[model samples]
Target: MNKPFADKLRKIASYVPGEQPQCAGRIKLNANENPYPPSPRVAAALRDFDAATLAFYPDANAHRLKNALAAQNGLKASQVFVGNGSDDVLALAFQSFFCSDQPILYPDITYSFYPVWCGLFRVPYETVPLGADFRVNPRAFDRRSGGVLLPNPNAPTGIGEPLALLEDILRHNADCVVIIDEAYVDFGAESAVSLLPKYENLLIVQTASKSRSLAGLRVGWAFGSETLIGTLEAVKNSYNSYTLDAVAIEAAAASVEDDAYFRKTCKQVMDTREASAEALRALGFSILPSQANFLFATHPQKNAAELFEALRAQNIFVRYFDLPRIDNYLRITVGTDAQMARLTDALKTILS
Candidate 1:
């Protein structure tokens, strides 16, 4: 019997997201979700929302959310593009800009979804290996390619590259589109948004998931030249005109309006992350210097797989990748002070 799916789909490997267990009393640090609650403004907006609006179709362009994002980023509304999430925006960008014969370029250990999008879009790609220190080498992407996609504070490793180096890659790839996924940029990394004026080819994609604590709302957007944004808008409209619902548009716009609360929560997470990294080091773990909300670490004396299982046994969850180069490392999201205290205590007992 023949499979209903296309032959190309059969040959592609799907991207597996982090585990999402629903068990009670589980300290979930596996997915890099914001440990803090969303801004009070979001609550207020939801309370004020009229349920009667659900009958009509939402704004196809999400103009309210786009305006808020554009104002915040010093861009015009025409220069902004909103989508269901950054993943959707990225997928569309892959299809819109990476159609050339040359393969797209990305870090070997990047967001992982990049390869999946490439596979889905039937776009050829090549992975540039990160340096021994796990930093992206700008010179490596100086050659010809279809386009470039990079996560600015790379995931799983949590190491951020300098903005100057990013500019170098942009300069090198003048003929192609360059995308900098700044999903975790709110944590501490320098954003490439400042280079927008000088480089018309750059697209900066960000999300409300991590910093705004609205992962469930599923709102993500991008900033780019009007031409690039227009292209994305055309592609998105062709696929799904109503990408964001009314509630999501209102809530996400409200999230952007409460700038003070956003900064406060981000600071809390950063503080906890530094403290947690120090605590892990005390337990003989070699922790990476992370600018993001998560810490990547490894213990020389303990197997990562065993430790992952042990943590799960204790009702604590953190991410572990069995892939090459980082098979021995664990990615631990920084939760609340109390949650991190519990995690450290568990590690103490496990190591003892």
Candidate 2:
């Protein structure tokens, strides 16, 4: 007799991430990764790590990282939670808040992982279509259920919703959790974190990946009411007690305190994104205004899939999705000024 897999596991499609290669020297702008190095203090933490701790199991609650994040966000440690990445924090949110009969509602074009997480946890979900301009129409969320999940400065499109509109959603979203994924908040958009105290249901999830440039360290955090954090902590405890490594905790703590480095790097990336967006528009590409560390540009005359492959041939990589509504667009990460120059030159040649 053959043993069967769980029915829940059988039906779901897991998240498919962008290309991460063993081969180096490729201009990788596919994923919204920070091109600048993380804070120098982060390196110091790693270099001076406690070697004796290797033999001991890490602090399962990760009190060190939590304390640091809490202090940085001006919240109590009880209102904070950390995970392997913001994706992990989001996964726990799905399990803790969305374990309901109602369907989780999100923009049809938002982070692809929202639906993937829903499927993974057997949560019911519904997708509301974005507007003709690919912006999340606030009115679409007026009627909702289990919870609300959205990425601000939403990925692939890089279009952001104003803070005023998000506050309105909080007023209306009293039934369940409202999760704001602020992975790209540092670049331009105003973060929804300030509303955390007023809205008990709000959970603002962020990562060290973009602004902190600690993607390699895989640190993510969630800020909300202590009760919501407790619920997520329960889920995290049930999954993996030691959700973060020792080195990661130290690096994250250091990175959060090094605001000077973070601000400088974000400014650099923002300046380049504006310049790059203009360049793409001049090249006949319709560029979406981005608040993130990347842009979503679609050439009216060129096939996006073709562009994906052609850019790969030039050793330049950007993200291209086969999903509905965004298939024609190229989600290009904002790299250094030099990298953007190389991409523009390549586009000119390809368009010519």
Candidate 3:
């Protein structure tokens, strides 16, 4: 450990990302990354791109990407903000909107990054507990909080709360910002974007990483009122002017323009998610009804830690968090049919 670090930095408990294994014949379902390739237009754009622009700095504002995103979401460019990824967008949001004496609110079992961001930004936060069924209780969020943030089709649990309940939470907390991270929205979950016009304080953050199959490119955005978007831009400019590179801007625009391919890939993942859930349930696992591309499941008779290790031994990886309440569960990403079939076969052998 390095000496004389900032006391706050030393106290911060960093977030642990899913493993990225480099092994032969690995079936990776650990991270909720899309199994499909990015839109062919992305490659076409890259191929046709002029390398000469690489000599100059990329656009600081990323106007083209923001405009495309705004057009796709039926909003103006002024109401859109893009970042390196949704993680960056989220960090900016934490810094911009959550600077209050009151504590921010999020689900106890929501995205692990929430707490990490709060700590990094020095924002006080309180975690509202999810219900016994692993669903959010929106009423618990009616308190006077600095802000509210939670992922739709909530991570690790992969269960989505209805828009009505989400609206109820937004209604109660109209004075503060409510960030609905729809990172997996395209999988099957209804986006809170529909409620954006009604609630000015609402911000819906999404990523091209999952549905658009551009994780490596790291593009993400947020849609909200012009006022909210302006705040994020202010924070972003203060943080990093050239957050996204030129290639990423062009590729993201191309991907968003090719709506057909995006829909096809998202539908494929959702279809595979449903089938995989059924397969896990048939294997004596209690799988959550997931609207995301991943499933949260636990077996009644088998130990989750053992299963996670066993799957890893067979070169098949899934996400397992040894946290309280969810220590018994495994969050499995939906891979291709063949990949999932291999996972199923591997599980059958483990169970037998």
Q: Candidate 1, TM-score vs. the true structure?
A: 0.97
TM-score of each: 0.97, 0.96, 0.97
Per-residue lDDT tens digits for candidate 3, residues 11-121, read 779999999999999999999999989999999999999999999999998999998988888889998999999999999998889989999999999899998988888
Better of 1 and 2 by TM-score: 1
Inter-residue clash pairs, candidate 3: none
Model with the higher lDDT, candidate 1 or 2: 1
Candidate 1's residue-wise lDDT over 1-352, tens digit each?
8876766555778999888988998899988999999999999999999999999999998999999988998989999999888888888899889999999999988787888878878899999999888998888998999999999899888998899999999999999999999999999999998999999999999999998999999999999999899999898888689999999999999999889999999999999999999999989999988988899999999999999999999999999998899999999998999999999999999999
* Local distance difference test, each candidate: 0.92, 0.89, 0.92
Instruction: Count backbone clashes in candidate 1.
Output: 0
Every candidate's CA RMSD: 1.4, 1.8, 1.4
Candidate 2 is scored at a TM of: 0.96
> Which residue pairs in candidate 2 collide?
none
